[model samples]
Target chain A: MRRLRLVIPAALALAAALALPAGAPAPAEARVGGRPPPFVLPAAAGGPTSAPFRMGDHLGQRPVAILFWATWCQPCQQELPFYESLYQRYREQGLRVVAISMDSQATIMRAGPNARRLNVTFDVVTDVDTRVTTQLNPRRAAPFSIWVDRAGRIVREQEGFSPAEQNAVAQGIAELVGR
Target chain B: MDLRRERRGAPRRRLAAPALLALVVLGASAARAQSDLSFELPGVGRTTFSLTSTTTLRYRGENYDANRFDDDFGSLYQRFDVALQADELRAEARIDLFVPHTVLVESRCVGRPLGVDDPSCYLDWDLRPERLTLRWEPSEWVVEAGDTQLVLGRGVALAFRKVDLLAVDNALRGGHVRYQGSNFRFGAHGGLANPQNIDPIDLRIVREPQDVVVGGNMAVVAPAPLGVTLGVHALRVGFEDVDSIDGVTRSRFTDRAVDVAGWSAEAAGLADGQLALYFEANGLRRTQRLVDQARSETGRGVYASAQLQLTELTILVEWKDYTNFLVAPETTEANARRIYSAAPPVEYDGPQRLRGIGNQRGGAIRMDYAFLPGPWSFSVNSALYAFNEEPHRDPFEGVLVSHSWMTLAKRQEYGGDLNWSLDLQGGARFETLLHDHDARFRSGDIDRWMIHGRLDITVGSGDHAFDFIVDHRHEREIRGDVAEFQIGGASVTYTFGIPFTLTLSLRWTDYQPGVVVSRGRREYNFLGGEFYPSLEVRWTFEPGTYLSLFAGQTPGGQLCSGGVCRDVPTFEGFQLTFVGRL
Candidate 1:
């Protein structure tokens, strides 16, 4: 049959040039537990705001973290001030660090005072309705990172945030606020 | 006004509000239940009646090339159907009665049997009704009609997402009105354009004209970028002039009264991601003693398409041009102003529209990409065409440009051909489903080289499923006319949940034959199988009924769609079907 059709496309082009193998792999690490999907934002400082911040309304209950930025994402603006220096080094070891802002309030009120001049204390939420980045994190891109656990349940989701994952999320928030 | 007392005063005015809400919910559930008198709640209304009938028996036989052991016979077909439906508020109306019979039962065991039976037995009849508009909106300014699909965007709902695939043609009538918000809406109707008749009465029901096209559609609320639409379409036509059977004059012998006048203009800032730029021009030019003489087939055309995203790719462009346009001719031109004296001058056939690209007059481009992120998608398209060539525009229009007798010529083998394509799709999922994968790759050329592939599999509680398809084709011809060929096919289908679905297909072809001593042979062998069974009933029905059986062998080809194509007559047959829904 015409020499088996000229040797089967020359043996499938030498098996696709020996499977052109090399490079481009590795990139999806951080994974601890689950339950971090709660949101309700309508506040850039206005009203509706009951989001990933309700660990029974603060009293020293700290230990949040969130982060999930975007503005056409440039690596989420070079990792938003290390989440504002990990909330000013665990704010008296309570650690809150919010920074949500998924843009669009005409681009986050023009970048929220350069993110409050990187002063870095805590409250700065505005997910302009990406439904809080797919509700806290359902693999919804954009430099994500979670960590709740003051019993809000979401002990680690992280996607682009390494410094050894910010020292394993500041050593698990100093072992859950024990300092 | 005694049309049976207005159809019995329409169920006595809907039995005066569900019989006054069934006597105030059966007198307060019979004063808070004193021993079940049957009147439950939470919502349920039942009133249905049905009657169905079907009978199909086909026998066709054929045998060609019978010599010595000359005995080949196979061809047969038959059909019978009956249906009825009734409802009372749980509204529904169906009446399908078809009596289709084509039987040449065992043509002397197999000498002739192909189409309409050479010996006689062909009966066809149809009547349908499943919805004669019975609607109720109660509030938002009222809507109460029966048997309807009277839609006019922004409200009223007889949807196809408001005119992207228009539909409204069924027969049987009703009337109603009301809507005072969302910018007012109203309706009125008679019937016969649609009352559930699935388009297909051969030759357009002997060339249209039974009149009954009274229209209504209004959505006027101008501002923020202009809008004006006014409509009127009328047809009471009955023009006949058919002859052909080699006797000529097969069309164009008139009669009158076909009215149509339309005006449409929509605007939304010309440039900058434009999205609505419309202009409509229609003229029927036939009022009283009908005088269209196909009026050189009057035509009008203007089109525009735009989509630009800028960041992260999205660009689409479109253009269209029209001409005398009035098409419908698959054989029926017995000298319509001299079609080469009633055919046969080698039958000159070319220019039907975009086939392997040639004779196109308009162009466009499209590009889309999302690239990696939630299962990738990519698209790359290119199209450019400008047609009409008779030795570069006019050599006395030699039969639409030297058609395949001069061997071929549209500027030497159909010029102006450029069709490019590229498409890629990707998918992945594993572990949570053991295995899930999707892959696609496509490439194109002006002449041809169309390839395709598919692979899927799922076992266990996934309810056993498997998929496979590999297609390869090659067609390139222009002058040197070596007529290349290569076709490969494979299809496997299986479904265990939807009652039944079994498909098996295999194809292979390698030829160069145009009969120059059978130039490089091996052209016959196309295997096939089709078995689909689905007929289960409950509530909600409309175009939903099936009984299919098929057997096949194919070597015959060429069948296109939308752009119209035909060249299919070569087969080994066995087909049985019964479908009804609504």
Candidate 2:
């Protein structure tokens, strides 16, 4: 009887989620295939800069990869070099990679400047005061990434970084870039 | 106003609306519309909604007493939450339904229960909707209603809080409004402090009045370059739920009202971006009615804090004290002024069980150092508690009815905490934290030292997460003897690929002390023990949707969001849950 009680509602919900049409209206959060929000910020010193780091600027022109990282995160330190290499390899595919840092504008004077010293040459934008990450992922877990297609739809995202995730991340980039 | 007279019909009425809402959510979420509002609604902004259903089944016996076991199945808890923000308009609402079991079965929730109040131990069921709020903001101005948490500077003087245990969301059913500019901020709010006893309460026989609280806060920030700010806050409260434990209920408020006001000032940029300081002082005036006699008195409190962060090191210091009626939320206090039993009451000078942070003077200092700015860090903290009085009284200088109240005696404490994480090959990492606090307290010059220590270790990477904690306290609260208590807990989780995750957890505790006879509870704590173990499995079929199954014996637990905590009941059962966005 208890099993039945548990099964009934769960079965109903399962049927509901499965029976619904493929094109139902959903919220624009990543949890359900919603388009990612757009942002524009200034590029901090000591990073690659081509455009002004505007997400919408790449909407129709190219696929975009947004990496929300912080200088204080060790995983970010480990993964940034890989992102630099990905950018160097994909720049020809019109792939725009935005590395947003969760650091104060001035703290960059101390905690920053080391990325370039480490040979990481990628577009790094500073989200001082946490305006963008608060709207994106309030948890602010670093090494977070969001993959968007040329149409501005977010195709993939993940929090935390490790070498094992590189393959999965590569797969996400390949999907959005139509590689 | 006889609650017993209304029991039969009240539960039905209370359960109907939330149940209906749940049905609507369940139906709406079943739609296959795959596009979030982003596609269909366009500029309406983003909205998030989730529907969840949980069913529990279990058996309880053995270790309960001699030989007694009861098989029970109940508390089919269902929840629906909807939140949305479309530009300036934002709103959220959550609906919950549960078996009102254990309403009549008396349980001890006084300090900490082995498990929270279990529905399987009760005989009632109820459902309700909460956190219903709708707001409109078009630049500089904001307004909302329904339920909300109220917090003030460091929350020492006052705060509106909710504990996650038993999903207890205590919010005033009211509205608040605020306006802000570059240099000034102001807000005012008013609502039902305690909107009658919602679900989980046997309201049918529990008659209580409504508590209404109204208040406003304003702050003036120094201009762009000044780095200083000042503010004032005030509140007038009308409590209607003050009832005695036996028979007739009496009001605790003076004419059922209390008024409070305070001032706050802050200055930052003390050392470029490394140092900052703030201070706030509160004055509380309350009129209490004891039988036919009413008395009013005023009390004052002060709070000051400083923070300094340079490179990988940070330092924080805080001090606070209140000497009369307090403006703080009762749950925010480390020590509660009132006992936490089924029917908690206030004690004036002596307490059998006391936990509260009010009517006391103390300060704590904390320092942190990050090793090369990595996951490894160390910190130290020291606090001093030298109360102004031995036997304390309210501003009116009267006994609480006839009960006495006393806080922890003059005490000094120091502790150190260290956290280190190791990077492993293939992204598998390990982390551990260890901390210990040693304290010496002198109450009537009978000084003694107590030591408390805790250790937490975790090792996992990618698809697996595991952590366990061991904690114990050794001290003598009573003079005759000193006995050591032990506590331990552990959890390990493994996620298979992206769709499934399994976890196991265990908890055991035996910490009994001869509490001061005048302080309360001389009996050993037999509520929790090593007999509890739990297992859970979760399957994420899609984004924002998860179906999980859990089975175990939970003694009693804590559920906290932010810094506030509420207790959860113990349960011996299997539960299946589904949470998905519809």
Candidate 3:
């Protein structure tokens, strides 16, 4: 075990010498292939509603997009509006969008008003209970977005969203749904 | 007042008989019987009233003249708090009474306790029934609509959940409802809190109260090995004229308010071998509106901690990161005081690294070991904190320090603390300020030496216990300001046949100067010592009733925990506490 530990560091050092510069640009998002875990959560802003909320439910029916957001988070405020516009543009075709809120029940009591004031029109659910989060410890952290194809498999997972990232999400959804 | 004193003293004698007889049978029985309670109320069918109150007085003072006139002078500060709750009237299915007063007394700006002939005093109080309320809890679900506390978690997110038993000062005051089940627990509370009341200045009137809503913690604890804690907190707090100082009436633009929302998830696993591992994460978002500037700022902060224990060793690590999008070009000052209450303002902007240095990165690593063979069980701990400019999310707060030792005190044991190094700091700036000519911290930049000592102390049953220590330290940073400090202290405690025990302690610090401070530097005898004699008397009048009186004096110094430390004020006074359960 000791020899292996020493060997690994030496191998890594050699690899670093051949690798790109330390300041190299971050890698572009690539096509991811894997089955997503299933989940069922309370719907957003409506009566206790549950659409086959699990990941497996949309496997063969439609292309699925899931976005994790919180009420007080500033980044989500800027990102969710963009998702809503894309959902509007593509919902009729075959794309299905699900917005998951990480806010606790206490926060939702106040954020519910803000969402209405902002005119958010989409399907939202609360992850406040940690039913789905503790299981999938996403690397990029919260405010993450994932796109799945009709075959019940994941295609992309973005840690944070910029205009470009959102556009990419829209294009991916369009391709999967339009197919 | 005299009759009330007589009534109180009368119970002391009434409770002493069964207590002494039970003590002869077993000491544990004496304490346990007094703590049992039915947790029932006398109302509804019956008619009765009860009044409960708790008072605490704490005073501390410190003095240090190592170098004179350099912000290192001795000081004194104290706080005396008194709180009372009364259940005044009860009839039918309800009881009505009001808590109308709270008093706090303080004495600030004392250079030293020993030199002062008299201490300055200040008082603050409030007597308002509007700040009070009434409630009824007839079952496992208690719904209280008044000033109360809701404490939960391991003190990470919702640290102070339960109302202070002594202070009775509730943090989240509003309507509180709690539900307790055999396998589950739930609580939800919402109300208005004056964050400014955290440190009330008026002492007479509550000010700057804001809107608050928090759900009590819900947790499930299995028989063993597996448990989880979950909680959600939210608040919309607005300061009353926090931004506008002119005291003018204006639009909502002049209102400074912040909406804060947070959630946390914690899980733990415990197995055999006395080992456990737990992880928790908390996230908070705060949005503030500066009415005068007509601008709103928003920020987010997150923290995560993981702790693990195996056999006799334990390790813990935590990370925190916060950023402000409202402040265009963010600096330390804006983030320190404005963004977070615990963080001190910074002078520059850098990556919130893991370690101590700014615009740099830092983190801390600790390892602990324990022994369990003889009458002694000791643990050795070492921690390292690193700083670099990495823009890391979580930053380390201070320098790296370590200690290795073994000791047996009280606990009916005998052992000795081996050689241990309290600190080994090596940053250029830190080395210069802390080691070179730093008389504020006693003697610095002196010779480094080993600390060898043994402390064997016993209580409750034993003739007498004695503890003593001697240490030597050397300095490398202060080559020109070479010096040495030899410190030694001893303590002896004696227990009497009755319910009274007395303890005596003495400490001395001797300095040997190697460098000159002035042109014609004359060696001065810097003798600092403390004589502490404490007497504790435990008097039990009857079941669930007792009075405790303890009086003593302790030396003042910079008390350090983990790798950080704050000066501990010198203390010389007596404290009497009474605890009753009925």
**lDDT by residue for model 3 (B390-489), tens:** 2233223212222223322112211122211111111111221122233443322322223334333222213222222222222232233434443345
Task: Report the Cα lDDT for candidate 3.
Answer: 0.35
Q: Docking category for candidate 3?
A: incorrect
Model 2, docking class:
incorrect
Off by over 4 Å in 2: A1-179, B2-33, B38-71, B100-122, B165-167, B194-209, B244-248, B252-254, B328-354, B373-375, B387-450, B460-469, B474-476, B479-484, B512-529, B557-569
lDDT of each residue in B1-582, candidate 2, tens digit only = 433323336558555544544553463453333454442246665533322222222223222321121223233445555455454565666664544323222222223211113323323344556557786766667677777555554344445543212233345568888775557888888887532222222221122235577888998877634557798888776655445421145444346555777888876555554566778787767665666887766676677767665665666666655564344322123212111111001111111122233454555565555544223445455554333222244312211111111111111010112112232111011111111112432323322334444444433344333434443434333322444333445565554434556778776544322211211231232333443578988665443344567877655433332222333344555655554444
**Per-candidate DockQ versus the true complex?**
0.01, 0.11, 0.01
Estimate the Cα RMSD of every predicted model relative to the unseen true structure: 34.6, 11.6, 26.0
Question: How many clashes show up per model?
Answer: 30, 46, 30
For residues B1-582, write the lDDT of model 1, one tens digit per residue.
Answer: 112122224344434333322322222221111121122233433222211212122222121112212112222111111111111122334333222221222223134432223312111222233333343433343343454433222111111110101111223244545443333344444443232212121111111222333444444434332332232222222223333321223344444223333343433232332232333333332332224534222322233444443323445454443222211121122112111001001111111222211112343454544432211324444444333322123211211111111110010000113211112222111111111112321111122222222222211112223333344444433222455555445665553322244567655444323321221222332111211122222110111222445565333334332223333323333544433211
- Tell me the native contact fraction for each prediction: 0.00, 0.08, 0.00
User: Model 3 chain B — which ten-residue stretch has the worst lDDT?
Assistant: B344-353
Worst 10 residues of 1 chain B by lDDT: B406-415
